[model samples]
Target: MAKTTLSLLPLILCLLYISGTAASANFIKASCSATAYPAVCVQSLSVFATTIQKSPRQLAQTALSVSLARAQSTKSFVTKLTKFKGLKAREYEAIKDCLEEMGDTVDRLSKSVLELKRVGKARGPDFLWHLSNVDTWVSAAITDGNTCMDGFAGRAMDGRIKTSIRARVTNVAQVTSNALALINQFAAKY
Candidate 1:
């Protein structure tokens, strides 16, 4: 009986470790689930869980960086879309409008990244100010992405173009919204 109990101890410890790991992974998914697009949030952020740990500020900064990169890439994609040949006048107009809004989104995301960086280095009362800036910029980025999609609403554009643009813009918006939620969470800790 004593031998059996000792043998089971190792198994119990291993089970405990496994459970703890699963809980940690669930923590990341739970945080992501708080966003508008839980799947996107989890996919984009889960990779950074080890580095992010439980730091709200780190999570916010990482989210901002992801959003910035996506916005920049989408901006480039939309720019090329504008130059696509054989577009009708209205289609061209819609794409052009989308391009402009995407540009704004990119710019706002860039600003958020910068502000988040500042927030990371800040250690005084000014931290709140920098954090607030990050929140505002991320919100603006989300709005910019939405505005881009709004341009396509009711427009008689090619179905392919419309779908492609909507997917890209929605991806950016989801990421930005995730960043904003993280920023707010961090701010509340202050």
Candidate 2:
């Protein structure tokens, strides 16, 4: 019995030590998880910034496509303005002026994007702000796009045109929302 108890004592102590170690490890893991948001945000932003950096040519190509589309739409609008038979001349002029203002605003935004791209190239992965509020980041993106659309809407001379612009703006807003959600999911996981 004495020999059996001596052997059992070491086994018991070993088991107790293992359990203590495991419990401490688990506690650390839980604590890390609880405080992981900022780190996750930083990591995800880094990945996103890197992705953006990796495809500068592609981004520029996409921007070109956007510019082309906007130009085509503006041409169509100008053609329509020239042929509008029912509207008074002054009304048509007002619409044309509004469209011109909106075009200038879009041009400014495109220029800003170009500038941002240049800054991003020079700064590497430091272009994106280290933001903790995922929602706010998303909201800002949407607001920026919407502000452009709003400039168009404010200049819009007719309900039909306003509605069309609003639909397009909503689509852009949805895309921005999706991007934010994706970023947030990545932040949560890593």
Candidate 3:
């Protein structure tokens, strides 16, 4: 009996591991489905699934951090682009505009982070209000990113710069959208 039990132990462990992974994936999918960009939401937040442990507040905080980090990186990228040689006046202006927008985006995300923290301490209706603030700020951050992208529309710039800026800003927007959705989900529970 001991020998048979020992032989089954590894199989049992493997099955448990697989089951845990499946459950984690399902949880991420369910949470991300609340967002507009579900695939991006899942991809961004799934990495932290184990650590997040299915806490809606933790999920919102994680999403905010991710969005803020991406916005900071993209802001830096756009600032550097302003220095690139041979840029036309319009291109330089566009880059500057994007830099300002990114700054605002970062600010909104920072506010959302604070709002999420407040949600933990506040009680009842106050908690709900804080969550609503977080959702609104995150949504505004997404809009800021989109407005930055719109600033570049129809501009005849170098393909490389255009593609790089668009990709980075789009990524920031998507993560911000996810953060808003997570905050909304958290609010809905209360």
Candidate 3 local lDDT, 37-106, one digit each (tens): 9999999888887766667778878888998999999999999999999988877888899999999998
Listed per candidate, the RMSD to the true structure in angstroms reads 4.2, 15.6, 2.5
Candidate 3 residue 113 Cα shift, in angstroms, is: 1.2
In model 3, the runs with Cα more than 4 Å from the true position are 1-21, 155-158
Query: Residue 67 of candidate 1: its Cα lDDT?
Result: 89
Candidate 2 stretches with Cα past 4 Å from truth are 1-75, 124-190
Model 2 agreement with the true structure over 1-190: per-residue lDDT tens digits:
9999998999999998667655544432332243224333222233233223324333222322343344345535544654667865555665565455445434543444454335335432443332233245345545655554544434434566556655554544443343344434433432
Better of 1 and 2 by lDDT: 1
The full ranking of all candidates by TM-score, starting with the best, is: 3, 1, 2
CA lDDT scores, all candidates in order: 0.81, 0.44, 0.85
Output the number of the lDDT-best candidate.
3
lDDT of 1 by residue, 49-121 (tens): 7667666777778888898899889889999988888987888888898888888888888887887888767
Candidate 1 positional error at 136, Å: 1.3
Superposed Cα RMSD, model 1: 4.2
Q: After superposition, how far is residue 4 of candidate 3 from its true place, in Å?
A: 11
Clash count for each candidate, listed in order shown = 0, 0, 0
